[model samples]
Target: MTLHQLRIFWAVAHARSFTKASKVLGLAQPSLSQQISKLEDDVGTQLFNRNRNELELTDAGIFLSRKAELILSSVDETLVGLKEFAEGTRGVIAVGALSSIARILLPRAMHRLSAEFPEVEVDIHETAPAEALELLYGRRLTMAILATDSIASSSVSFHQTEVFSDPYVLAVPRGIDLAQVNDVEADLAEPDRAVVNSTIQFNFGSQHKRRIEAWYQKVLPHYRVIGQTRTYEVALSMVQEGLGVAVVPALTACVGADQSYDVTLYRTSLPDRRLVALTPSQYVRVEPFASCLRHLRETGDDIALPHIEPGPPLMKAL
Candidate 1:
């Protein structure tokens, strides 16, 4: 019934192990158990069943766990709001972002926010773009950075700011000879040049795959994609081993010098991809989240976004 008990219950439900919850809460196992026991008694339900080395939530436990998570999250947000109010600063901002943007934008934004508004605590969640939008809609995330091309719903208001634009570029190995060309432009233009056999890697559940498939349909109709992997690093490694050529986002192709393969960047006639910041219409008018969005829009050129666009479509995949 108390916030302390709810916290313990939520942690146990999330971790599915009392011992793990104890470690996370920095409490002894016995103390954690006693607190959970009191909560169960007050609720008049047996929340968990101990089934030979496993903890399973009972029906009532499952029901309470969801409610408890919402309660605790709201309390946490309220406390952050109060703290910010007391300090005379913008309140806390909760942001969700795609993995690609998380790699480059989040770190720099966090650093800048800390320097400029130390009182504002910026919490970031990194996940697929689709999940980030769901969180934003549920009011769990105050804002998000997502792909502009992927935005589907009219209900969710977004302040679109172009963070980075990367043209699709082909990554090929060092020694390969295109039959009819000496340079990138010539290679792209050559009618007799062989289409390099390549494997395309992408996050399995990304919107970017559609764009990529569309690109292939239009340009490389005869070429065979030998493989597909989930991450850019894996795809890049495969390309480095001379497995095949890949069309990757230009930013991700900027690998460090330590990588042992030669990479060639080429211009593609494919449409350029863009990264944008999204938020609810109401939040756009708020102070802290608004300021953060403004800062990102103003300084987007400096941030590097992943080649893949963030977010899932509003309609379910058939």
Candidate 2:
């Protein structure tokens, strides 16, 4: 008859015992029984068959339990919708991104978001760009910051905002001597003479994979990729151990030397990387969504990206 009575009835029906339901509802067993009895009287049917220590829901009880579940779930979802509508500043926003980007960029953006809008919460999912896009399309994430070159064909439509461009950099062991290549530009132009033979590979997708392979053929003809990794940090670490040079996006390299270890950076002439923010078209202009994007662009603009220097192993970037 009442929502409260329905709640009690549903709990007991699921628990299958008056005593168990009483414990779950934190009510006295007799009080719980009385309420259910009152409800059965209102419905003009027996809701439960109570045995000594066991309980069974009658046909009516089973029907009501199913109805209660639907009612409660709908009520909960409605409340969440209303809360989001009224409060543009509060609640959680789910974001998916590459781990390296999440490390370097997300930290700063989250800090700023928290400082400016204390009520909102950011939930970050560290994943590959392609996988992140899948999550975005699936509605698991509201937004994703990643490269979009891998999504070949999909029915999912999303609005992509290019936040920044990242260049490819070779992560070499710090101890390697670059004196062999007198003309740095010429060496990258012809990989046949580039001295570093061992290399580490970071695979994003088939398209990215083929592009990297082409770059290697054009720049490091004699080089052999010793190991394959999914993350730039791992590739950088392998390079630090004197394994081989790793070609990674500057976005990952600029994450700092902690994960990079003893790796030194070298500028490569390969295609520059694209970093984009993909959002559902409907929410792209919405607040907090709009403000979150503003923070991303702000941090991106101020980043001190590293690059290949002419004289040494490090180059300053935008």
Cα lDDT of model 1 by residue, 1-318, tens digit: 898888788767755677766765667989988998999899898999977666789999989877875676567556645655565655668887755466556666677767677778877887666656655544567777876666765424445655667776666655554433433334553332343534465754456777677665545555667888755656767777777767766666644322223555455656776877776555565556666776776556664433332211210121
Distance from true location, Cα of 263 in model 1, Å: 2.2
The TM-score between candidate 2 and the true structure equals 0.65
**Residue range with the least summed lDDT across 10 consecutive positions in model 1:** 309-318
Please list the residue runs of candidate 2 whose C-alpha ends up more than 4 Å from where it truly belongs after superposition: 1-89, 153-156, 179-195, 256-261, 310-318
Q: For residues 1-318, what per-residue lDDT tens digits would candidate 2 score against the true structure?
A: 987788788667756677766755668999998999899999999988878778887887778877876665455455555666785536677898888888888888888888877888889999887557555533457788877565434414566777777778777777665635543455444332232667788877787889888876765566677889988888877777776787888777764533335566767766677778887665566556777888888888877776453423222221
- Alpha-carbon lDDT of model 2: 0.71
What are the RMSD figures for all models against the true structure?
9.0, 13.0
Best by the TM-score measure: 2
* Residue 71 accuracy (lDDT) in model 2: 69
Candidate 2 colliding pairs, count:
3
Clashing pairs in 1: 129-311, 130-311, 130-312
Give the C-alpha miss distance for residue 6 in model 1, angstroms.
21
